[model samples]
Target: MSSAPTPAPGTSTYRERLVPGPAGVAAVVLFAVMCGLVVLVSSTVAAAITSLTVLVVGLVLVAVTSPVVEVRGRELHAGRAHIPVDLLGETEVLDADGVRTALGPGYDPRSFACLRTWTKGAVTARVLDPADPTPSWLVSTRRPAALRAAIEAARGA
Candidate 1:
């Protein structure tokens, strides 16, 4: 396996990029077909163009919306929200079962979640923002333990 990339000097950074899984990718095809169908009965060329446009736009939307959880310097970044490291409370690494529960009945509607259907493990970071709607951040990752450790290490640093 390739080694982990080094973080920049004078700073500690742990970053994990989430990619679209096979199941999630199915939506792109569905979108393309739906767009093409709207024009297919009229003209094949129009259908083809619409399909291409929808596919490209759908892919870009998916790509842009994909989550990236990162701990850099004194901040924790989950999606578009960033909070200070000091404000972060205890972080727990969720196992497969734990992940399921967290995503299921135990899930809080107001909490921030960067979940992936493929990844079976996740790390939850307690948010200290009492005034904010989100209580914590549940970030999906293939290496849950490593992600947890990195957050701890960064916080300690």
Candidate 2:
């Protein structure tokens, strides 16, 4: 018996690029204005601290919402976090109901590691190991289904 031939390596079946939506842009702009106000109204030391904090936070937010999924070579990078090609498993696109189910209660936290709450949908990728520090990432994507398919295909699943 003969098996079907495999496609060329590093060839991706789907690809999607996600950027900040209107809400995210508004947030960045608002934060920037607030930082400027701090500089305008306070001492240089205070301004420096406020500006630094804002800058760091803004960068992180931008990073998180930068791109939901990228498939290149044999790897997949979701948002600011990177997931190895080999460890990836099944992929699913979550609609509103799916998001609620996957995230559970208090899904949106006010600070640190909080996935952007305003995303239209999410892509959940299965992980291989139980002890892996990189738990499944809930990525904010405008095109969640496409992103999930791309990730799954890239992983050769």
In terms of TM-score, the best-performing candidate is 1
lDDT of 1 by residue, 42-106 (tens): 99999999999989888888889887877776676777877776676888999889888887877
Report the poorest 10 consecutive residues by lDDT, candidate 2: 106-115
- Candidate 2 Cα outliers beyond 4 Å, as residue runs: 1-18, 26-68, 105-114, 130-135
- CA shift at 155, candidate 1, in angstroms? 1.5
What overall lDDT, based on C-alpha atoms, would model 1 receive against the true structure?
0.79
Clashing pairs in 2: none
Best prediction by lDDT: 1
Query: How good is model 1 by TM-score?
Result: 0.74
Per-residue lDDT of model 2, residues 17-135, tens digit only: 56566777677767866786768676777766776678678867786655546665566666565656677667677887887787777453421131456666877766676667555
What's the distance in Å from true for residue 21, model 1?
A: 0.8
Q: In model 2, how many backbone clashes occur?
A: 0
TM-score of each: 0.74, 0.56
Q: After aligning candidate 1 to the native by TM-score, how far in Å is the CA of 41 from where it should be?
A: 1.4
